[model samples]
Target: MDAVVKALSARVDAHDAGEKIVHRPTREEAEAAVRTLIAYAGDDPDREGLVETPKRVAKAYRELFGGYEEDAGTVLAKVFEDVEGYGDMVLVRDIPFHSHCEHHMVPFHGSAHIAYFPSKGVVGLSKLARVVDVFARRLQTQETMTQQIADAVEDALQPRGIAVLIEAEHMCMSMRGVRKSGSSTVTTVFTGIFREEPAEQARFFTQVRLGK
Candidate 1:
């Protein structure tokens, strides 16, 4: 059953890989959209102080959502198999990231905790963080981002198990609506051994909360 799940996950990853190659709007078009949004907000986009705001915003958007150009699999392509038979779980925690909410387009900033049990080899420690960043620098929900990170690791490394947990504070909630500040959203995903074994899952959770 585990093998079946991993196989299906790999197929899904392959299908998704092909879907990311869509055309994107030009910078001028993006700037024009920003100007339209500014006008929609009842602000004069052409005003002396606001005239350059659209250009600045367009440039910032490219950096903020740069994940669209990155491929998670490519980032995990280079692996190291000389672990001396170390099969224990590899955990990387407190990886800070900033992402935008898909619905509100507001910012959500926080950290992610990732872990995986290698079967034959392990990926670079920093690549784990890069995978997190690849999905983070896009419009996302915490739930989807958590699963994407786990799936990317599973598909690329075929680990014995994978676990991902993310905790973030969304500006959409803090800066508007209920105005609840300091409130964070936590999402988690577990696969393979992590999903089949409660003890392993518990350990992952405990380790994540230990220093917090």
Candidate 2:
């Protein structure tokens, strides 16, 4: 079966009496898994330098992967009631995020550039960063993460256009695959006006990229 199908099936199986599925990983399970990773890395977890590492890593990941415990829809729930009819392009740039690549379970550290044109009501400025965080906390691919973040924001705000860009360095490719330490990966997602209008997308890209 496809990944989506499997995920859906798992969700269905995990439903409660109200038919709602809770998807967040437990703190205990995550900490135990950190121990597993520590062992897999061929290290002694009891050593002084590494003794607190597992617990620290788990605690750190609780914040990093906090998205699994949050509803992105709810995070963006509060839209601006009054913007004084402010309807220009709303762009949030260089929103820092980190996630583990699902394939290798290695860290991918990056920043995202997000932009959207409001249709009617717009979201708060911080909501943009929260939306980005919701996706970046999971084990993911840069490509899918980019698309999912863009889709979630578009769905929540119903924007005229939405665009996202992620620039990350994958430890999997660097620490394992090709072993190139300095190379970074970039991914982008564009929808609505950004998808239909070439100039809009280019302008968005030029704005974020040139500034960097």
lDDT (CA) per prediction: 0.87, 0.79
Backbone clash count for every predicted candidate, in the order shown: 0, 0
Error of 1 at 127 (Å): 0.5
| Residue pairs with backbone atoms closer than 3 Å in model 2 (clashes) | none
Off by over 4 Å in 1: 1-21
RMSD of each: 8.2, 6.7
Quote the lDDT for 187 in model 1.
91
Q: Residue 61 in candidate 2 has what lDDT?
A: 69
lDDT of 1 by residue, 63-178 (tens): 89778767899999998999999998899999999999989999999999999999979999999999988998888888889988988898888999999999999999999999
Q: Assess candidate 2 and give its TM-score to the true structure.
A: 0.79
- For 1-212, candidate 2 gives per-residue lDDT tens digits of 34532353323211124656646455566677888888898997778898777778867865775666566788888888588887778888989888888898788998999999988688888988988787777778888888878777877889888988889999998899789998988888888899999999989988897768
